[model samples]
Target: MQIYLPIAEMSVNLFLLVGLGGIVGVLSGMFGVGGGFLMTPLLFFIGIPPAIAVASEANQILGASTSGAIAHFKRRTVDVKMGLLLVLGGVVGSAFGVELFGILKNLGQLELIIKICYVFFLGIIGLLMFVESIRALRDIKKNKKRLKKRHHSWMQGLPLKMRFRASNLYISSIPALVIGFFVGILAAIMGVGGGFIMVPAMIYILGMPTKVVVGTSLFQIIFVTGTTTFLHASKNFSVDIVLATLLLIGGVVGAQIGTRLGLRLQSEQLRILLAILVLSMCFKIALELFVAPQEIYLLLRRI
Candidate 1:
């Protein structure tokens, strides 16, 4: 359990932290998420403070995402224009979110409130995605030929026409910017990387191909999370760099494995599995919200 740091004269629970990181990394790589949603909660369950959990996870995502983004960039899958717009929104949104966080911190019930909100959104989004994916699968099964007629969506005809060669989509810049802003605020406040929401938004809303979605999403995450980490470090000093490094190590390796597996997967199958996973997490969070925790003792624990 003891992990000695080379620079710092301190030891940590390396096994547990790395193991948790490994699980989160695999899930993140496979699901195309930053794993902050999972990492923050896991950190809390293992006794790390919420503030520290958020900051550390942000730092970890910075490294994990940077590496992933490089790989994606090398494959020529990143939409640079789209990524920049999202990052611009994300920067502004995170500032607002920080102010909101300050207000909520004074309220003292923010943890419970945030959990409730997380469960609600996760459930709603998950169910919607699941149903849609199922319907799409049925349609594909019924008539696979329907997919052959590749017609551009009406979104492509919207104003502020912009071309994304990597994603091979010509879409409206305004709409994409709006979506990015909305997702960025959520990412900042919830301490999530916004990949779960952003990827879907790009695929379903912006009508990008699934093949390029993951890479571009990771591309955006690098900047979003890196900025987040810097902000937390300079302002809050909450980032634990050592912790982030351990997580990044696990995440990078897991991502490579997941990328390979993702290539072998059928689009429908991947969608269905991802849908199920999202729904399962949604149900689990809801259960936690509805079910009361068991208090074993009248113990007052301090973080």
Candidate 2:
């Protein structure tokens, strides 16, 4: 059935929206990532206005993340203290990101900027994850033992050190704060939960345990995306509540399924799968940048 998105001023297939949510929700559950990286691009491909897509995706992420985080909490895999610190930084970053988004939209470069950011970040993250996963898998195959815990690095020497007992690390909060800030900015600008970036950063940069990383990332994403949703609704007025509602219904269920599946898979395998998905998205967006458009100019109606 077709449904009207009042804010977007468009009609779309209801099933299609639900399906998209389901797909992203599965990813969100499986990787403990919000799945916005995948959803936002799909929205663009389907002709949703960039601003509307970003704003609505943020709202959708809030629901998906909440479901996934609760599941992780039950497993006792979340680092609550760490997640809160990240949220502190994310809030500040999101505020700046919203203002910047408004400026870019006014300049008529929002879509291009969003696409460019997607391609750039996805390419870097995908390559890193792919290479790391391969090495990890190879070591496992060779029966080589891996370190149970990461050693102290430069990051550990930084100021504001705090103990994250769940992850069993004494690390500086500054790094975590910085990471959250950047992820929040990306989340606001790109309409993602920032899980893809946060997951990897938590793993390699902070040396957080794989078991806890996804849950912690999801916890922070909830607040960041929630803040973005409100800002977009009040400031940009681009959020389509009807669209977000449809997506949430499907996404919530999909996330539950994905979370269960994640428990059965090896960490390396999950990272590899996520990397492939990221690279695929990066390629798609990059291709659009080089490909010629069917129409060189768009005609807008005058009020």
lDDT computed for candidate 1? 0.70
Which pairs of residues collide in candidate 1?
A: none
Model 2: pairs clashing at backbone N, Cα or C within 3 Å:
none
Instruction: Name the runs in model 1 displaced over 4 angstroms.
Output: 3-12, 132-172, 209-212, 262-277, 292-303
Model 2: what TM-score?
0.87
Q: Which residue window of length 10 is worst by lDDT in model 2?
A: 294-303
Per-residue accuracy of model 2 over 1-303 as CA lDDT, tens digit each: 999999889999999999988888878777665678888888998899888999999998888778667888899999999999999899888988999998888877888899999899889978988998898899989999776546556775689889999999888899889998998898789999888788778987889999999889988999999998999888888889998899989888888788788889776788898899889989999988889988889754221
**TM-score of every model versus the real structure:** 0.77, 0.87
Weakest ten-residue segment in model 1 by summed lDDT:
294-303
